[model samples]
Target: MIGPETPRRTVLRSALAATGTAALGVALAACGDKDSLSEQANSGSDKGYIAGDGVVTQLPPSKRGHPVEAGGKLLNGKHFDLADWRGNILVLNLWYAACPPCRKEAKDVEAAYRAYKDKGVRFLGVNVRDGAAAAKSYMRTFDITYPVMLDTAGRVVSALHGVLPPEATPSTLLLDPKGRIAGRVVGEVDKTTLKGMIGDLRT
Candidate 1:
């Protein structure tokens, strides 16, 4: 919570927390008024990145979680297409090795993963600002076994919303099998609270 961490150094290091978008207008205004609809008709079968059909099943713009980019790569060099994770419950967290709060939440995240991973759940980690080495060390020390993507440039964080410093580290986002956000822990991981939320999601 010291000051804004630069996107170059560390996305998570910027002391940013979930500010949540104020409105889609401000969020989308920068794009100007481009009628993507017109492009779809002209292209016939849309396949390009900027085509109107580029978006599939838009998941109510996430004010907290990532925008679910086209292609995300894991630390292990695996690929995660957002569409593929649709059928399994996904747990997402933004963390950094230096954040004290993130360190505290690591154990809880590991415990939850251990408990629910085999029960039709998937966990994804976004390590911003830190490299594979730091992430590996942290994972090793904390016993985290889930697959995580290294967010070298913090694109995922930017997609969530501009973070504010003193923001809670280890922020959590729980998504249903359908990929919609079911719950979030914006400030630290409260197992009692998270577990209760998880119980609700199952119901």
Candidate 2:
């Protein structure tokens, strides 16, 4: 027998559907129970968070956004302020431990950092989610020596609200020496491409 739909039932159904969808996306992205939250980010699902599509956008100096003002504590408990890195190009990467794409691109990121670190280019990581232990473990596993900001509360993400929200788990933002956003990569960054961008910024 068919019954008339009630408001309570309607709301419940909607809620369940949304929950299921989110769970499904996460599961697919995660691939396995052992996969960390960062690895799951590689699925590129559009449940709530933005999924990176490997798109690169470089803005001309005249059209670049204003300087970014954000700061947070690193995984090792050291405070990091973006302003301190001024006068040098900064590469900021948003990542998490469980993201597969993030893991895949870690080496490339480190290589690029090594290639440009002595040339006045700096690299910082923004761990979107995960505890310090997890983040530190991931870094150790990936051999990433760069300091990563622990953004457990999304403070850094919120600070970049309009200019660069870092909607994707593995997003990369390039800041010119003046601290203005110069380039952005929505997904895993390509090593050569990143090196090229940094080279151009130096000129």
Candidate 3:
């Protein structure tokens, strides 16, 4: 069970671990509130990038929003639509190449996908930044086998803006079989927590 906490130390660790030594020169920063992320991005603080506060929220069916309507060309140039995944549990991970937490959690997300792909679950990545070359490089580095959408135009982000905050890289969203938002983790994903969330949806 993944609970929520706002410990600055924990947040720092996750961010640094994801960034690796090569990116250490860049300052690590984050926003506890979704709106704060937008403000930070506009102000050019830390390049307007936002790391999550390690918060996890799961909504009951009644609390979920309407089915998400988003899709676009993938890194492989394939079209993807959220609506088409309605019958299976879906996971959407929003990330950019430079996000430390995204780097840290890539392996775990891929593991989860491999574990659940044949069990009526699907995972899609939404890359908010990076061109094909950079995005593909990141995917290769992380050994990510899931489909990742190139959301450079922010079309997918705009569609999911109701639940996903702008500039909140490394945010993970879970959708129930019906395509409505079911849960979210706003930072480096805890592997056990993610698997537990997926298990709960199965039941």
Candidate 4:
């Protein structure tokens, strides 16, 4: 049976109720799932977003240094040595699974790793404030083919610069073959953008 038309307020209430139901569905699906949470964090109606240092036109600025001391291991049960990746251009990401933009870029990073892991290019993940389980799950979920380290203490967090405004989560810092700082990306980036920026290694 058809129901009679209701007042404008009643229609608005019904619309809101429907939206709430959809949101609940999304939450239920991602309950306790790290990758799912990451995907949800990055999902929005916005078709695209251009993130960069616009007006100021200035980035963190690259510095010269060797062998990331604050890096390696302090959180994970094991350790990682920056020296091992010497002689290779590498993409270094400092992120937390809980960070929205980090999740958004996780897949792109993995794809790049697979495409260049054999081309003398490397990808290293530095996880901060995230345990082994979450970090592992994130890697597996995204089919990541690279190695990651857990930096629970975030000791190297301060040393690894080159992030944009927010300068908080989803930060990407590049390291040259000699372990020196090379530009950075503060938010999610596409494969083409990454490829272009990585070209700096030649200089």
Q: What is the TM-score of each predicted model, taking all chains together? A: 0.64, 0.72, 0.75, 0.61
* TM-score winner between candidates 2 and 3: 3
Error of 2 at 65 (Å): 2.4
lDDT (C-alpha) at residue 79 in model 4: 60
Each candidate: RMSD to true structure?
A: 13.8, 15.1, 10.2, 17.0
Candidate 4, residues 85-200, lDDT tens digits: the string is 67887787777776666666778887777877887888778776688888777777777767777767654443331222223345566667765545455456556656655654
lDDT of candidate 2 over 1-203, digit per residue (tens):
11132111110001000001111111100111112222333333443244453345566676554566666567778877778889999999988888767777789999999888999999999888889899989999989988887767765554443333335667788889988777766556768778978987898
> Which runs of model 2 end up more than 4 angstroms from their true locations?
1-51, 162-166
Better structure of 1 and 2 per lDDT: 2
Best by lDDT: 3
With a 3 Å backbone cut-off (N, CA, C), the pairs that clash in candidate 1 are 1-166, 5-14, 15-165, 17-164
For model 1, the run of ten residues with the poorest summed lDDT:
6-15
lDDT of 1 at 26: 16
The alpha-carbon deviation from the true structure for residue 48 of candidate 1, after best TM-score superposition, in angstroms, is: 37
lDDT of 1 by residue, 1-203 (tens): 32232111111111112222423111210111123322332333322111012111112233223233235678888877756777777778778787766776688888888888887788888786689999999999898898887766655544444221123245676667666554545535645555655666676
Model 3 deviation from native, Cα RMSD in Å: 10.2
The lDDT values for all models are 0.54, 0.64, 0.67, 0.50
